[model samples]
Target: MKMLKMLSVVFLSAMIFTACNDDNTTNGKGKASIYITDAPIDDDNVAAVIISVNSVEANGPEGWETIDEFEEPVDIDLLSYQNGEAFLLTENEMDAGTYSEVRLILNIQEKVNDQIQNEGSYIEYLDGSKEPLFVPSGGQSGYKAKGEFTIPVGGVVGVTLDFDVRKAVVKAGNSGNFILKPTIRLIANQDAAMINGHFEPDNLDSAGYNKVVAFAYENDTFTESETNEPAEGEIRFPNAVTSSVIIGGDFTLAFMKSGTYDLYFASYDENGGYVELIGSYQDVTLEAGTKLELDLELNLLN
Candidate 1:
């Protein structure tokens, strides 16, 4: 896939706020800044992966508050924010307390006639292939993420929402249309780790399966016999940093929290299709500010 570079445009308003404080005991409110980042997907044919984000909402003791709202739906090409790079979505002063949920409201759009119009969020490929990216029922309510994080009085809290495109876009049966089943995770910028490696497929052609997907399951076990069962642990799909395939068949999965994780890989085809399970490494431990490297020879399922 051809890599493209795009500059981020921040839509800031004239709202004055106090600097974020690191200590929680400070008087009133703290600053919370949210960012948008992507975990790399292994699809070579896609030229752009665009999504429309309307607003960001956070739930605190004061019920729900709009942290950031876009006057118009902002179309973001996620492919540009790979490998730890991120764009600021919104920033606002929030109360100094534990915020339980953060939600993103997406505006799905479509192409009508020759002009690109807002019907809903959709994906367009380099081959001129297009698909409808549908957000499920709950997404309309908001893509709600649960976690208890404190905005220290005067201290700034940075949250990065990782959008894993590979896991989020699902093909609708034999039809060419796709569904945007968004798979997202929240990572505090300060507590993230990395995992890198090389994937060597014995007989697969590089062009056919151009993308590599790494799935991280925290505190989980995956036995070959239990492949059909839903395993436990937080599954950080393709959105983890270093999750995209690099030149020379190398892959990296970054922004992982410190824990014991089971890492699995799979081959992704040109048409946004997952070929098969490449292989997996169990009991992989990650620590803060540490990088784990593991090169693997993929085991073909068939």
Candidate 2:
């Protein structure tokens, strides 16, 4: 049997800009730009995951302000922006202040020939299966994320929103349908860090796999038993600082915060059907703006 290789890599780009006016006034306006990226999910059965974004908005003490709007909705294939790549969404000028919320409007429905059609969003599977994926309350109300951030005068701030596809895409029980719940985080570009390395398997060709899965746990006491499934408060699978997929023995988990974490790696078959626990390291400390490198060997038991 010829097995297909599935590798997972995801990224999100949310650039926040705050510029100083000519007079450097306290309440002056600045330029705010928005971008979109993806954290890819590796599944042999899934061929494509597409989403259409229409507009972006931000809220502050004054009121809700429009950052960027698209006359035609932008269709994005989440899997394509892998390995730390990103694309621009939109840009606009806004007053300098602390924005408390951000909103993303998606194209879930459209009016065609004087009739409301279901021309919103969909996903394609490897088995030639296609289905519509719905976003609850995302069309009319838009998806809103709340956080407090300040744009200082004479400074440019870049923020990144990491969208995790593994946790956001849900499969209905035996129904073969998928739902997009959207798991995202807003992080300051300056405070971000990365952890990357290479893994060498004993037998590369016959290993039956093409990628290795890496996970980071905040708790130092996390063990192998907890990795079999997602354990609330213990194992952070989808939102786990950065659950990276190492391709061709190389991997990089970026945008991590400064702290101590437990790192674990496992090998999976090309079709993503089989998995084996290689090993793990505990108390790995990550500093801000620093790239920490660590290498390992996958020792499979006979």
Candidate 3:
């Protein structure tokens, strides 16, 4: 009878020990989040940059198993700021395991069709949502996080991705006579290797209806054709004509390693009877990752 009692006591102690260990270890999961701010941006209305986290997994014996098993929140927001100011929040707990890869997707949601009617024409493309944009590359498909990162179990980490508004544009819908131009905005990263610029066409179109007006604005001020003078720029409003439209070279800019920059393009006559404002911007990393082109358009009703 004494021997039987001792066996029962040993089994009960083992069960208690197992429960304690399970409580101490992390369930295996982490969190990620980020946003953008308009630093020294002249405009009051600023767009928000969105961040997304997905495809979280480990590189251990189990392979790339989803962390769906964890019950905690996977995304965290540290804080937010107005204009040049911003804040961030970090997740207090992270999976206590070593991870091989963590994939993240970034994008911006802007209201399309917002327009200011100039002259008698309704020359505006406003009110719609842009497709999801991938960072490091302005692709319809979200870009991938390059190098590998590891998350310590139950530890917290915060990451910030700064995007300049200078490189964003609004694309208008078709179904109109004249093709309207896009409004331009510029955003620059101090360490960014590329900058955006624009130029005006030197000649008219095949229809011989060459009433084109181009302007390059800096810091909300307009200037004449100064393509080769100081800031070096070029442009071709009616880029492609029905029978034949001249092709102007690309508008590329070499930027300072670290500093602020801004530039934009607006055209009076695009093609046929259309007024267009097309602008191309991109999210540039210090390394030459990828260049994104935002082709925004608008049409005027005469």
Candidate 4:
């Protein structure tokens, strides 16, 4: 059902956009750009999700005018960019106005008799195995994230697309084929916020944590027992808006809108299984363009 709903959103704006010749056209225009980021997937075995992007476009006077064009499709490792980190997809000038949506033209592959075509998009595993990350009927068109951003006269505006890989990558029922449903959002860079913090490393005296995942749930809505697994395609923290993987005692929950949230920390086993809820804090509010910091003490697990 989730995959169906996601595909429905994709089909609504899956039109194709052609390449545009660059005239170096920038005079009395506003600078508009797009960035790409991701949320951590809850699978420990997977090393990366690679996607090839040809160009990025915005909805404007010419239907889909290419703002930034690449000579060759760039392969991006989505996992390498997360936790407030983003890759600049494009940066160019446009006439000052409101744009409806951003389209990322992915160079996808065609499947022939259950075999994938040349390297379109695929997943890399820790043990050196790769499999096609299929996007249904996505090769012939574009995928989009809908949002509104206005460019001021002679001003610059940046929008970041947050790709939630946890919800976007799903396996076919008993088939082992992974599909990408493209759950994404566009946030103006000036209006984005984040919660970042450092964890005091505590070697649990021979029972140390293997992995930790941080979640920013709706304010006052997180529960200790939400860590229990639900259905197959869903995770425990249903109300979580964003998540981050704690790396080297640092974690950042990025691309969040200004709102109150409850931050929760939990430990995961090597296989990404929920081990236990480490701790949580309530009523943490964020304002636009601010990075709130919280220093987690080591005694939270006691």
Top-TM-score candidate index: 4
Candidates in order: C-alpha RMSD to true structure: 8.3, 7.0, 22.1, 8.9
Q: Each candidate's lDDT (Cα)?
A: 0.63, 0.62, 0.27, 0.73
Evaluate residue 60 in candidate 3 and report its C-alpha lDDT on the 0 to 100 scale: 33
Of the pair 1 and 2, which is ahead by TM-score? Answer: 2
**What would the per-residue lDDT of candidate 2 be over residues 1-302, giving only the tens digit for each residue?**
11112122333233334455565455476555554455557576788777788788888757888777888888877666544555556656667777877778888644446554555577778887777776666676676665566655555555555556666667655555466675765555556566766666554446666667777778565654654664432223443655777777777666666788887766677686436666776677776656677665555221
Task: Provide the clashing-pair count of each candidate structure.
Answer: 15, 5, 36, 0
**1 versus 3: better TM-score goes to:** 1
* Model 2 misplaced stretches (Cα beyond 4 Å): 1-27, 109-118, 127-129, 173-176, 201-210, 221-239, 299-302
lDDT of 3 by residue, 1-302 (tens): 00111112211111111121333344654432222222111122323323333323323335553432223322322112322232332223344444444232222222235532122111111233223321322112222222233443433333223222222222223522222122211122222233322222332333233332222222323233332222212133212100011135133332223222233333333333324433322222223212222222222111
> How well does candidate 2 score on lDDT at residue 255?
61
Deviation in angstroms for 81 in model 1? 2.0
| Ranking 2 against 3 by lDDT, winner | 2
Candidate 4 weakest ten by summed lDDT: 1-10
Per lDDT, the best of the predicted structures is: 4
Model 3 lDDT, residue 151, Cα: 43
Which of the predicted structures, 2 or 4, would earn the higher TM-score when compared with the native? 4
Ranking by TM-score: 4, 2, 1, 3
The pairs that clash in candidate 2 are 9-40, 10-39, 10-40, 11-38, 11-39
Sequence-dependent TM-score of model 2: 0.77
